[model samples]
Target: MNDSGRAERRETVAEHKRTIILDAARAVFEAEGLQGASMRMIAKAAGYTPGAIYAYFPSKEHIYAAALGESLERLKAATEAAVATGTPAQRFVAAGLAFFDFYDTNPRDLDLGFYLFRGGIHPQGLSVDLNAELNTKLLATLEPLRVAVLDDGAGADRARVVTADVLAHASGLLLLAHTKRLALFGGDARAMMRTHLCERLARGNTPESG
Candidate 1:
C-alpha cells in the first residue's frame, strides 16, 4: 500500500479501537457513574488492559464527555426529524415533545445526559472545554424548536425566551414524572406538555407591542 493508503488504514483502525473503548466506557459510566467509575472498570468491560484503554482515551472524564456527546447527537437527530414536516407552530410543538419523549422514554439516557446518577452539574475531572462543548451539543438539540418559534413570528429574543421556557418545562415535568411526584396531582406529563404548548402557541398568536 502507498504511504497515504497505509495512513488512512491506520487511522481507521485507531478509530475502531477508540469506539470499542468508548462503548465499554459508556457501560461502565451507566453502571457506576463518573465519580465511581474508573479506567480499570472500563478496560475490564472492553476486555482490554488499562494501558490499552489509555492509549485511546486519556482519562475517564474524556470518555464520559465523548459518550455524552454521542447521546446529545441522538437527541439532536430526534428533534430535527420532528420538525421536518409541519407548520411553524406545529413544528415547534413537535420538536419540544420529541425532546421530552427522548428523555422520558430513555430514562437511563436522561440520567446520563443530566449526570443524575453521576456528578450532576459539577462532574469531576471534566475540563472547562469539555464541559462547554457538551453544553453546546445539548443546546444544539433545542435549536430546531427555537427556529420554529422564530418562524412563528416571535422576535429573536422572544424566540430564545420561549425556547428556554419550553426546555425548562419539559425537564421539570420529566423529573416529576420519573420520580412519581406528578402522580400525586393526577397529572400526566405528556398531556401537561401538550396543554402547555397549546397555551404558548395561543399566546404567541396574540398581537404584542414592545
Candidate 2:
C-alpha cells in the first residue's frame, strides 16, 4: 500500500481496537459493578494487557465515560429517527417515546448512562466538573426535540423548560419502572409517557396527536 493507504489502514485499526476496548470495559463494568470491576478484568475481556487497556483509557472512570457516551449516542440516534418524519406534535411526542422505549428495552444502557440503582453506583476517579459535563452531552442529545417543541411556538425559555420537564418526567418514570416501583402507583409507564407529551402539546396549542 502507498503511504497514504497505509495511514488510513492504521487509523481504521486504531478505531477497531478502541471499540473493542470500549465494549469489553462496558461489559466488565456491568458484570463486576464499577466498584469491583478492575482494569485487569477489562484487559482480559478485551484480549489486551492491562497496560494496553490503559493506553486507550487512562482509568476505569474514563472507560465508564466512554460507555456512557455510547449510550447517549444510541439515544440520539433513536430519538432523531423518531423525529425524522412527523407532524410537529407527532415528532415531539415521538422523541419523548423514543427516550422511554430506549430505557425500557435497554436497561443496561440506561444503568450505564443514568444512576438507576440509587446509591449502588457511583463514579470513580473523576473530578466533579467532568461528571457534570456528561449531563451537558445528555441535554445536547435532546436539543432537536426542543427545537421541534419550539416550532409549536413555545417561547425560548418555555420551550427549553418543556423539553427539560419531559425528559425529567420520563427519567423519573423509567427509574420507577426499573426499580419495579411504578406498578405500586398503578402507572403504565409507556402510556403515561405518551399521555404526558400529548398533554404538553395540547397546552402549547399544538395538535395533541399526529
Candidate 3:
C-alpha cells in the first residue's frame, strides 16, 4: 500500500481498537468500580493484549472516564426521549423517573458515572465541549419548566433559578432512591417523590392571592 493508503488503514484500525478498548473498559468499570478495575482485565475483556489497551488509553482513569462519558450520553438520550410527550411538569417527572429507571436497570453504569466523581480524580476524558453538550441537553429538558415558571411575569433570572432547583431536587431524589435509603416510602417511593416535587414546583409558580 502507498503511504496515504497505509495511513488510512492505520487510522481505521486504530478507531476499531479504540472502540473495543472502550467497550471492555465499560464492562470492567461497571463490575469493578474505578479503583478496582485494571488494564490487564480490560485487555482480557476486549480480547486484546494489555499493550494494545495502553496504546489507546494511558491509564485506567482514562478508560474509566471514557466509559463514563458514553454512559452519560446514553442517560441524556434516555431523558430526552422520555420527556418528549407530556406537559412540562409531567415531562419533568418523567425525566426523573427515566433517570431512575436507567440506574435501576444499569446500576454498574450509574456507579461508573456518578460514584467516580466522588473519588476526586477530575475525570479528564470528557472534553469541555462534551460538557457543554450535556449542559445543553439538560437545559433543553428544563425548557418547558422555564416557560411554565415564567409565564406569570416572573423574571428570567428567577425562572433560571427555578429550573436549577427542579433539576437539583430530581437528582437528589434519584440518588437517595438508588442508595435504597428511600425505601421508607415502599415500592412507589419514586412516584411519590416525583409527584411531590411536581406539586411543589407548580405551587411555587402559582399566582398567590394578596
Candidate 4:
C-alpha cells in the first residue's frame, strides 16, 4: 500500500480497537458501576489483556466517560423519536413517555447519565469536563419538548421554563419508578407520565389557567 493508504489503514484499525474497548467498557460499567468496575474486568470482557485496554483507554474513568456518552446518544435518539410525531400536545405526551420508557428499560443507563457514582470528580488523565459534551447532547434533546409546550408566539424564556418543568416532571417520575417508589402509588412509569400529561393539558385548557 502507498504510505498514505497505510496511515489510513492504521487509523481505521485504531478506531476499531477503541470501539471494541468502549463496547466492553460499557458492559462492565453497566454490571459493576463506575467506582466498582475495573480496567482488568473490562479487558477480560473485551477479550483483551488488561494492558491492551489501557492502550486505548488510559483509565477506567475515560472508558466510563465514553460509555456514558454512547448511552446519552441513545437516550437522545429515543427522546427525539418520541417527540417526532403527533400534534404539539401529542408530541409533548410522547416526549414525556419516551423519557420515562427509555430509563425504565435501561435503569443502568439512567444511573450513568445522572452520575450515580461518577459524581463531579475526575480521575487521572480524564478531563474534569469529560462528561460535559454528553450533558450538552442531553440538553439538546429538550428542543422538541420546548416546541411542544410553548403556545404560539411564546417567548424563549417561557419555552425554557415550560421545558424545564416538563423535564423535571419526567425525570422525577423515572427516578421514582426506578427506585420502586412509584409502585406504592399503584402506577408504573407510563401511568405516571400519562397522568402528569393529562393534568398539564387540563390546566392548559382551563379558562383561568396560567
Candidate that would win on TM-score:
1
CA lDDT of each candidate? Answer: 0.88, 0.83, 0.68, 0.75
lDDT string, candidate 3, 1-210, tens digits: 899999999999998888889987777766776667789999999999999889888888767656666777777687767767766566656666676666667767656655543344344345575556655654764565566556645567777776677667666666666678778667565676577656755665533511
Candidate 2 lDDT, 1-210, residue by residue in tens: 899999999999989999999998878877777777888999999999999988888888788888887888888888888888878888899999998998899998888877433336466555677688787778877877798888877767777788888988898898899989998988899999999988888777433322
Q: How would you encode candidate 4's per-residue C-alpha lDDT over 1-210 as one tens digit per residue?
A: 999999999999999988888888877766776777888999999899998888888889888778777877887788899976688788878877777788889887777776654433333344658757656777777767777776433566766766677788888887787778988988767786788876776566333456
Q: What is the lDDT of residue 22 in candidate 2?
A: 90
Q: After superposition, how far is residue 12 of candidate 4 from its true place, in Å?
A: 6.0
Task: Give me the runs in candidate 4 sitting further than 4 Å from their true place.
Answer: 1-16, 117-127, 151-153, 205-210
Candidate numbers, best lDDT first, in rank order = 1, 2, 4, 3
Order the candidates by TM-score, highest first — what do you get?
1, 2, 4, 3
- Candidate 3 wrong stretches, greater than 4 Å: 1-16, 116-156, 185-187, 206-210
Mind giving the per-residue lDDT tens digits that candidate 1 earns over 66-147?
8889889999999999999989999988999999999999887787777876556455678999989998998899999999
Give per-model TM-scores: 0.88, 0.87, 0.66, 0.77
User: Against the correct fold, how does model 2 do in TM-score?
Assistant: 0.87
User: Whose lDDT is higher: candidate 2's or candidate 4's?
Assistant: 2
